[model samples]
Target: MPSGRLPVVNPWRFETNQATVQIKVGTYYSQVWTRAINAWNSKKVFTFKIVKGPAQITILPAQSNEASLIKQNFVGVAYVNHDNTKRITSVQLHLVNSLLKSNGYTTSQRVNVAEHELGHAMGLAHNPSKQSVMYKTTRYVSIQPIDVKNAKDLYSIPASQYFINLPATTSTTANKDVIANGAGDRLFKSPFETRSVQALVDPSTIY
Candidate 1:
């Protein structure tokens, strides 16, 4: 049940039952955020969809906090996966214009930081390399390469993996390996799922 956020238990990943991120922005920055997420997901097989429309974004009075971030968390800090109903796994925004200026990143650079952290909200972990959007550090623009690969890997975990029940196995080499060892629930072909999925695990669900 623990998401990837718990580094001590499950490092390099995290998940939310759900999250509702309020993307606080100015009119111009609003456009920038949309463009960034679009470009970020364009190269990947998975896409992060906005849950609903007519969203309310919060744009607090900006303050100075860049130096504090670097010396402290090394990234901007926000509540991670703290949604009561929808878990907002992460959030970030420029606090003080002067704070970013103090740290030597432009407005665009600050947006990159925001985008990178949003990527984390979407279940990405920090990558050490500059090539990744998940990369811990960027030159101030462009999400390099490794960032996309890591995101894909995180996204590939099948729904079944979340639970303890294993299913039919597949081969590794020339022979199909029975990795599940027949201990899994069942691997019945589809179309029967709606009527008989309970049978897939146990027949008790059926009256």
Candidate 2:
């Protein structure tokens, strides 16, 4: 709602303000993701718990450059699943571990990237302010006040406004390709275009 912040359209948000997300990793990277989740939980507006099993929100390590469905050099991607009503039912977060290290992201930056992607999953759009974690690209290592305010504002909106109505007619092959890409839900891409940091959304297929 603040000025200078980029608007987010058709935000895919959860039904409630509190929910746990499952991380798909069993490595040190999981620790970094935990930190990101903790950072967002700090706002007290929402709580993200790390759980197991087939979760509504899933976090996993990107296997290779092929993880990028947008054909750009990206570090993270988040796919959201919404029903015909438009409320988000599930989400998938993909992080490129090898690319992050090779591209020189420090432990803090890695955590920041995780946080940024999670923000996308939460339905926050890219903000233009460099100080905000929702910015399209940045070296920021954590969430800013504006980012928190943005989250608060986003959640405060009516649920009906957060969703949309899309056509139901879709192809089976496209669905298979999305599954093969590991984008377990509908694709939505992060707006960032460079090596700094970003989230992901797949627009090629419909679900």
Best by TM-score: 2
Candidate 2: Cα lDDT at 144: 84
Task: Give the Cα error of residue 175 in candidate 1, in Å.
Answer: 52
Q: What do the candidate models score in CA lDDT, each in turn?
A: 0.40, 0.62
lDDT of 1 by residue, 111-201 (tens): 6765665555555545545555444454355665555555555555544463234232322233222222121111222221110000011
Collision pairs in model 1: 4-13, 4-14, 18-87, 19-87, 63-95, 63-96, 81-89, 131-145, 132-147
Give the best candidate by lDDT.
2
C-alpha TM-score for every candidate: 0.51, 0.72
- Residue 46 C-alpha lDDT in model 1: 42
**lDDT tens readout by residue for model 2, 4-104:** 75444234567766667888786777888999899899888678877777777888655554544334545676665554544666677877665576667
